[model samples]
Target: MRAGHLLLSRSSLSHLLLIFTLLSTFTAASFVRSRAPSPQRTAGAASRRDLISDTVENILHPVIHFAPTVLGISINNKGLQLDNGTNPNDPVQVSQALQTQPPPIDLGQLLQDITPNYNTSKTLDSACSAIHTALPNNDYVGRVCTTPECIQSTTHYYNARQAGNRPACVTYPTSSQDVVTIMKLLREYDVTYAIKAVGHSTGYNFTTALGFSSTTGILIDMSKMKAVSYDASTGIARWEPGQSWGELATTMAQYGAQVVGGRLGAVGPGLSFGGGISWYSGQVGFASDTTHAFEIVLADGTFIIATQDNQYSDLWWAAKVGMNSFGIITAVHSRTLPGTTTYGGSVIFPTDKMLDVLGAYANWINGGADKCKKGFVLPAITDFFVESLITRLNIFEFFFDGTDPGECFKDFNIINTLYDDRKVQPYPDFLNKALTNQQFVFSGFNNALYSSVTDLINKDQLLAIYNAWEEYSVQTSGAYLQNTLSFSVITKTGLAASQANGGNAMGVSGGDGYLWVCYAEGSIPAIGALMDTKLFGLTPQAAQAVPKSQRKLPLYANYARLEQKPFLTYGGIELLRQIKKKYDPDNFISSHTTGHDFY
Candidate 1:
């Protein structure tokens, strides 16, 4: 502890001082908006803004009490006050905020957090023991399965390559309170952990992993909290983080309604928060747009609700695509719509017409995309590749909430096909068919490179992406198994749908770009993982071909490779960092959790 600076060995005093200044001054909205002003101040005007509010008084009150540690403080009639003569409860004075080249801090003392370096087993034991004793009844699901096969099974993800990294323990919470208890213990112990909601995430350390020093020590599987309830009057549906789209779709069908959810049945909330792309996305926008409320647990174990109209509205917009930075969401409440039946199915084209299909697919999204009736309700569409031991086929999965096979979809009729199963069926049945054989038989370690691009490139560019995938598929034909490169448009209509719901972390706007989904599938023991990354055309040289303005953020977090930091691609990564600090002051999240290092 030092009197004139924040002296801690972990970081420099100046940097720490600067950080504290930003954390105590800037609002969460400042960092995330695409056109937001920079934090740097000019000498002329001392414009100021308040970052804290009475709602979060409990969090910042201690900071005020400890102001003397870095900014200096003194006792006064109103209580503990800053030495700078500012009101402790008044809005922070930005005019007195830190400058670009901040001077040495003058304080009476320093406060430091517990170091992240600790014995992994001891911390894990402590966390698990506390959770076990606290939730001793049917609500808790905590275990340390020693069997190799069982440990191996828990690691299985949509992509099989991510299956081998197991953590020391797995704990499932039955309710938000359980999450609050578990988070408190883990944060207290400074334990690194991963979160798994059905293991659909392909990114490493996202769900669970083993090395404590390297990122994984504990895995918090959110499976036991599967509860879904719908209110007919309000037309709102609430679901636990663990529930899958398949389960929700089927259940909501009984109520003659449906929530904007995953296209493939197995996807859970992680994708929803990461700008969830769906078969219904064209009209409904991202499934995440449907999210109206989130019951979340902050790093400090404080359970709070983040919504558009609340005091935490900034956090609400940030959480839209900020992933786990804001908190661990326990329940997501979204409005449901009437009419769940849809007409469409898979149409398989011969391998000879691959080029034709790719070209036509490009045309469908580029020129004919406007055929969307309401501009928002798009004819559900997906074209992908299915490859197995001896078979390779191109399939187009289509659907629409309406009865007719709309003209917007008639473009597919141009190509000769083998099996065409387009028909009118319930939404649940449509997604059930999406749970195809490939997911079961040949699924393993895989990576998806998704992005929002300026527009659909030429057939040649699209072919290049596919050709690269094909080459990799041929090379690692045995290890990774199958891969497909597909594209989905985020048309003007879809963009509005998302914007109407408080927007999200994705900086994309209508007319800005098309969402590209490039995925590679294979069995365990990945031979194509590296090549899977290369197929995206996200490399520096590849991105250079596009105009600077059109160079969109690379891969979606859910579909990104292990090394990718999708949060940085967001326009508000800095705002997300400030929000992280406000909620996770002790740096517990960066030390103990995986995915997107906000700072």
Candidate 2:
């Protein structure tokens, strides 16, 4: 996110600038370690030591050198020219060179050579020790743990697949200043790190560090930062990154208010960064759209507040759906609505009624369902594996902003159901119940979600898509413990609400209705790869069933697979890239952390 000036001392600024210059100027090929003896230097040629010294001097001073050309472009009276005599100023040639070029100089080697007593081969234990030394005598030290018990508690992910990662240490920061201190130390020591809020993300490396060679890795646990408050005068709600939807909803209910948040209770505030969809989305838009401001810690360890009409407004726009590419979000302030009584609960039907359920859902949405802005529905064909056999069930979740849904869900009401639990209840109570039920059924399984988006489909298209997913699931039943195919309608009212409130990065419009189709699976580690590969293949086949015009819709980032490039479909790639470059010119976040790839 955008910020004011970097918060670094003069000496640190100079050191960082020197490092940045060296990294930008040289390629890895220039510093490759060789076992062969050095060649004899010709008369008047400089030695390797002399070359390095001269390079450092030239970087510090703003003097241009012609001897050592970069990217085959040399500064002269004739201007920039490539080795092949092509114009280096041409965007096409420059882009081609960037694509074909090798990686930049190694930071570890560069730091070791440039900084006094800086070790390039630091271990996780040593790094944690260093952090402890830096923050000694502070309460934060107690939160920084390297013990197995602490790590296990900090790395408790909703998806079992993510729980296998063992970082060098886990540090829980309870305030923005605490995060700033930890972030500064991590950057100073050149440690790779990942930020974890509630650990609901299913993508590999999305909330954990994958691998660390010579350097160490750390997990910044935000769970201890759980805090929530609401303002009665402004109708605004403020929550820390660690607060879950259920917690936030329950807290807001005390104030007779609510903010658009995750549908599930366990999801953290991080959901807003991925364009969160909530029961209130039909009326207020995505959770990201409801956000009024973000308290962020930039890559350089500087804190800034981003809002719709502020100096950091660009960051405000991008952070809405930019994921974790920008910086760490410490707190979110959002617009709130009155906490009205809600009508919502799950309805379960036997597998035999799948077609009837699908038909009714399609008919409801097609027949002016968008006009009922206060209503939302999600229908899923869920399967449970028990005793070597699978049992399939049709589960439909419905919600209305008020006490009743009126005629909004009449089509689905007529279908015979094996079980029905629809009722009028307080919003917070419904969310807590849903989360309790989900955890009882799906906890402890290695889970992931694969998703795609397309125009709202007809009965035949829905049936075709369901059959394709069901065939694949049955064929690979041995690979997974549970499989579910679910759909969320993105109505015209939702799109309009998003625009009415300052728009987000997801480039959807109210031209036509759409559905975010997701395939969620729970499996063992032994077959996770096979399940992912086969499930990924369903995207193209599902897209083919929809009209060609609506085949390239933006995939929902919250439910997307690691392989899916949701950002590319946002229709604002160039703007996003520019914002990234503006805020993170050194590429510090992308280099030192792992998550969804935005560049």
Candidate 3:
């Protein structure tokens, strides 16, 4: 683009808005097939034809920020294409003599000529065919699997989008080099592919294969890549993306070190990249903050070691905190700290105690700096299960970093409880529990939840939100399966700890503690879509109940709806653009994957 580029006409603006609205609803029609490019870009530079193609590209593929559409010119099987000129893959220029007259080389066989090993055409077949075809030839066929044994290995991600859907074929990579080979194959064939770690992610495309029908993309499962090692002298732990926090904790217990990570036994690398929130956050910080570097494979089948100081440092920092983008991380060398026994446990209370419990939680978070700082601490996590529209159970899943329950649990001790399970446990033993409320929301239930800043919320406001959840759950319980509401506290201790050891990218202001209000709905497939609409809607309504002066809601991307734009709240779109430009200059991969928008 020059001093001035062609501004999108009012007519084009109208078209974009229409497309956005249509895409807002989950309909196949909204995802139009990308059209093929023209036979040749015979026009000269900055010609009227070039500008038209550039303008159309901006409208069709909108990013957080669209740089001047370079030229979408390429020489693929179709010929000298020039539809999306700014496409980084496009050739900069062709010899002047060649552009004037087309060569006699057969266009039909041209694609294979460039990449002879790949499929000559985008063959219309299940992704299984591609996987089967590549198996015997690639060196990784021993790890390549179409057998039930291999597929059965990843049955744990209970969400339907993850567990129910299966990939056409699963390729297990044992190392970063294996991933590079897989990436090259996928790119050569132009096949849609997805990368899976510990199957806990929620999206259909993220954990399974992609397809126009179903089961199309070849899945790269990272389970076998669970190679873990550590350099005690350097305090750096090399963890394959597939390793779980629980597994790592047990391993580190032997070494007297711990890697900050998700509290659950199954939470894996994907969440690690999405700002891993852990119980230890109050004592240390976010899991991502301890990430020393990343071994990543870029979209173009290139490998780079990204560190805070590496040439690809921008990509490293971006992947650490942001949603999936730019590349697939193979392994993360994370920093570790001394491991020790921690104390805390669960207490049970009736639903009626919510008001009192929330008030106490608010007070606990509002308490002074020393109690909430990066030292000995106790953080509270609650799971309020809606046993019925009329009855609720409050379970306090609180913890302290030391071997004894200190005064931090004082606010909660006063509340009468039906049972007490608090006790001191080794770090590895405590990390085994994954605190999801499974008693109410089962494996089969389709669920979604939202989190809002709790500092502005009080006990009365929380009770109102609970009331809304109860009402919705009651109305839908008859038609659907069930629904529930829960609360988790991220005290100032955790907030301040997130800023420790180089800080993390959770996108929160440092040094202040707040409550995270969480609501979950579980239902049958028929009403799952409806539940999603309602669940996403009620989040803001819950926030609005807070006084206008105090209302500042930043939805956690980890818990947000698919359509929700959470990246913007993390920081700014401007920074997102600068990094994307440096990393994925060629707009090849981002569009095919799931995550929030680039922002």
The TM-scores of all predictions, comma-separated, are: 0.71, 0.76, 0.70
lDDT of 1 by residue, 335-387 (tens): 78788878767666665677787787766666555455322212211121211
Give the poorly placed runs of model 1, Cα more than 4 Å off.
Answer: 1-120, 138-153, 205-216, 373-390, 435-454, 526-549
- Per-candidate alpha-carbon RMSD to the true structure: 22.3, 20.7, 20.2
Which candidate tops lDDT?
2
Top candidate, metric TM-score = 2
lDDT of 3: 0.52
lDDT of 3 by residue, 1-599 (tens): 11012123334543553443232222111111221221221211121112123445445444311211121212111212223332312211121212232322221111111111211123313333555554443322221233454534333343433443333356667777777776766666666556667655544332222211112345677777777788999989888877777777887778787777776665667777877666666665566877889888888879899888868767766776665676778888988877657775546554456567767766655563237443222222222111111122344566666675556667777987765666788876765642232232233334455666545455677666666655554333322333446555555656565565545444566645555666665443323455566666767776666776664445566666556566665644566667877777865566655556664
Candidate 3 lDDT at 139 equals 22
Collision count of model 2? 0
Tens digits of per-residue lDDT for model 2 on 52-96? 245564454433333224323221112112346433323233323
lDDT agreement with native, every candidate: 0.55, 0.65, 0.52
Instruction: Say which prediction, candidate 1 or candidate 2, comes out ahead on lDDT.
Output: 2
The reply for model 2, stretches above 4 Å from the true place, is: 1-127, 134-155, 205-216, 435-441
The order by descending TM-score is 2, 1, 3
Higher-ranked by lDDT: 1 or 3: 1
